[model samples]
Target: MRGLSRGPPAARPPRPPGRNGPAYTPQRMADVSAPEPPKPPPTLPDAEIAALREAGRAWEKAPGRSSAGPEVAPGLDVAETRGRPGEHYVRIVRSQTQGFEPVAPGWLEATPRAIAPDTDFGRIRRRLRTALLGSPLSIHRVLHERLDKVRALPVLSSDALSSVAYATEQIVLILAVAGTAAISADLLPIMGVIALLIIIVCLSYRQTIKAYPQGGGSYIVAKDNLGPVAGLIAGSALMTDYILTVAVSVASGYDQIQSVFPAAVHYRVAACITVVVLIAVANLRGLRQAGNIFAAPTYLFIGAIILTVTVNLFRLITGSIHPTGTSIHIPMTESFTDLGGMVLVLLFLKAFSSGCSALTGIEAISDGILAFKVPEWRNARTTLTIMGTLCVVMFCGITIGTEVL
Candidate 1:
């Protein structure tokens, strides 16, 4: 005990990493020290302020834009003599009444510089955009080339047109649930009516696209004829329809694939998410590239349907195929009303309405009218007409092919 007391206590061993200890470094130490906010600079003289305002007015009143943006050549204002220009600091408070004070003087003495494409953060952003999409198109080059009728039809019509793949399936699924009642028999007349409705909807849209060449679909119609409230309602409804349509399309497309390869069912979310992300990225690239990317698939789909329809119609007309559409059973049912006449009427109405949902995505074309090239209205109108006719023919063809197949 005497020997231990003679010397200072030996230093304790370094603590291991745990609740009491963490790894430390000079960088971390620096980060921990909070830097003081920079102070605002002194106010400018009234003469200099007046000169800046005059320069601003001159820039605004300038007849045209110079190569380097606006030329504010009213007079030169004196800059601060003490420090380098624009090297001061200021705080930007969010309050409207308390704006950030100008940190530099005589900013209006020189013409504004056009931002160089390769400057600072701009270079990083452009590379990112180019990597994700393609080269950026100029404002004038946007919608620069008109889509000939062949390209426009597929470009504008894909959403409505792609419905053929599943619309008939949905209709059949609904009717066949009646079970053993020869449900397929009613498919023809119901489908014929649906086909007619599709045509009518297309015709109405065609007229609308022509009248409002700067298109915004039902929203525009409501805004133009009715009031803003009506326009808002239409817009909200259209948005709801678009979301639901995408959900249904994703689900149905996934299910179709899942039926063939059961493994795909496990990755359903991933598959759908990938599709959405790809579509978003493609579109953000600008209209020309997006159209180019979409045109091929859309036309291929159209071509396949046309071929199938052509083959089936040819067989039917040649009497080589038997017509199975006329043999399905019909069912009678009632709600709590014991199937009243009005109830049956409502059922037919409901069925027709359900089938008519195939027409949901038709409004997409109108939303993109400006994407049409020179003579925008005329090209948009023509594209719209072609879209409508294609939608009608495809919907009808698919319905008929359900019987033919």
Candidate 2:
């Protein structure tokens, strides 16, 4: 059956405009007529405030200000007070006023006591923290404790120095994928480029330290010279870089641990967590203590690397040790001939970029200029130079050693 057709629905008439620019319902009308919110209380005048303070001081100083009883003259008195039935005691009295009143001569002084947190948990937490991190230092103590170049080198340059432990491996691993020929052809060039970059960066940061001794690092530099946006970007990038640095450093150390003790390979996550916690606790022990704690390891690592490299070079020069050169034959999986010129160029570029990880912490000295002793910028610059030199030497030495033997 067909349904009857219907016409379009009619539109309702618009409401008349109200005084407030729109149609008013009962709620709107009420809101429009409602009283305004109470205004904020007016501030007291300076003269009135001063007068109030004066009155308060006068009240505080009044002779009869004591709430216990009326004030009495200062004098010595021995009063017999009943303690119990048929028992009495003699009490020595001096000033009658209490609360901030001065005591008479020979009167025992009240011992000063510190107010501590009431909860046992709070006390336990505080004591545990103290045990783990050592006593907290006052601002004055921390300020007086500045780093010398010797100590500052390890503290500020550790991250950059530590990266050398793996940066060469990263470069080699990338190049080796293309075949041994690629490694022989590209490794030295990549190392040279990275070293040059390092020198340039170190010099540039020396200038940065001179210009910005106050040391906010890239954030302050970018903010002042460029804009806030650029500063924020630089700051965020630094945070991300730091997080990755910690992760990489920890992983590298873990790999070394596994190499020494194969059983440790099973507890990778646990070991990483433990190491991170220990590092955090060490840092919390204050900067001076942290430096002292880390100084030994940094120096030991430098010495070991230098000694090993020296011995290897000596042996090579004397022909006492034979070199293990890379194979010239192409691998079946991947070969340079198959990759073509552009791909090989890209591969070399990738390896060079990977090797640049050694430069990760180069800005640390500039960023922490105030961490050094007197003539902070000079000391920091010196430390930076030392770090750069060590990095270049160790890096090149390691690459050359790997290539030869």
Candidate 3:
């Protein structure tokens, strides 16, 4: 045993006891330990907090993270920011204050600044002004120059007056279809009703114009008075009406032209397209310039109708008038009784109502009240009166002419 024994076998130093006894130490106990918790971030200074709030506000107003802030004023820095916490920082730099700048002071309150004298900017500016405010010599100008135009108005008034021509045609067509006899009896009453409706519409639109001087028209009124949905409906209806006006006016004009030049009878679409192009060109030229060009024709058209009606009225009262070619043997449609009496009357009424199309432009003046010059309300009012009178006269003349013929 002494010869074969290992040194380690002699050194059995310790053995762990069972429960409650001392335990043996492990050699690798210190290798893997639990980590400690992290520390909190540093607090921001008062100046940094204020700067952050201001930056946030600026970003909200006009979103960007640049250094620019409010305009430089006395003891104020437009460009300055507090540095991060626990870091070096720079305060807002100070500057001198500059007072308010006038957009336009004397000539017109905020008159648009004139463009460069040598550049096309002048022409563009002039065109823009003309489109928005109208020329000094045109009906549009007169409307813009006075507030009364909002109530009574001119260019749109003339448009209303022009409606009489088309309105009478609609009535005559309705009556002729109903039978020549029906026309002779109902014509005057129908005219009276239509006239009454026109007046009502005019009055309604006048109130609308006064209430909303902005150009939203029916859309604005509906939105303000009714709600957004109603405004949308009004807007859609107006757009539809404008489209119909273009189509109907051109088609009717084409028919008139065809009567004189039978060769053009088949070219109705072409004529309509031409008229649309012309209108677009006019619009592109700017409202004021176009108004200047159209003023003479508009007035002449009124004058012509007035002169013709006055002469015709005198002749009719004196028993010397002769009917025109179309009026002499006016053809009546025979499809009325076939459609049933009640249905036909309803149809005629509907047509008569449609003829009230003349009243469509009545609100345009009011919508554009802001377009007028100084003393806006007064200018608008005067223009409105002129428009109303002209419209009344023109409507009456056209109605009577249709009746007499």
Clashing pairs in 1: 181-329, 182-328, 182-329, 183-329, 185-328, 334-339
Report the C-alpha displacement of residue 223, candidate 3, in angstroms.
0.8
Which sequence of candidate numbers ranks them by TM-score, best first? Answer: 2, 1, 3
> Which has the greatest TM-score?
2
What is the C-alpha local distance difference test score of each model?
0.71, 0.83, 0.65
**Model 2 spans with C-alpha error above 4 angstroms:** 1-115, 325-336
Off by over 4 Å in 3: 1-154, 322-341
Model 1 alpha-carbon drift over 4 Å, by segment: 1-126, 143-148, 180-182, 322-344
Write model 3 residue lDDT over 271-355, tens digit each, in one string: 7898888777665555455566567767787788889878988898899987677744445465655666786678668767866
Ranking by lDDT: 2, 1, 3
lDDT of 3 at 69: 81
Top candidate, metric lDDT: 2
Each candidate's TM vs. the true structure? Answer: 0.65, 0.71, 0.61
Clashes of 3: 18
For residues 1-405, could you state the per-residue lDDT of candidate 2 as single tens digits?
268677798899888887887788988779879688999875999899899999999998999657686565334453657588777675655334221223565443332112234699978887897899886565567886689988898889999999998999999888877877788888988989999999998888888888988885888889999999999999999888888999999999999989999998889999898998998998788778878989999999999999988988998899897755644565625455776788888988999988999988888888988889889888998999999999998988888887777
lDDT of 1 by residue, 51-164 (tens): 999999899888985557665532333343445677674443321223222335522212112232647688788678779987645444554644655556666666677776
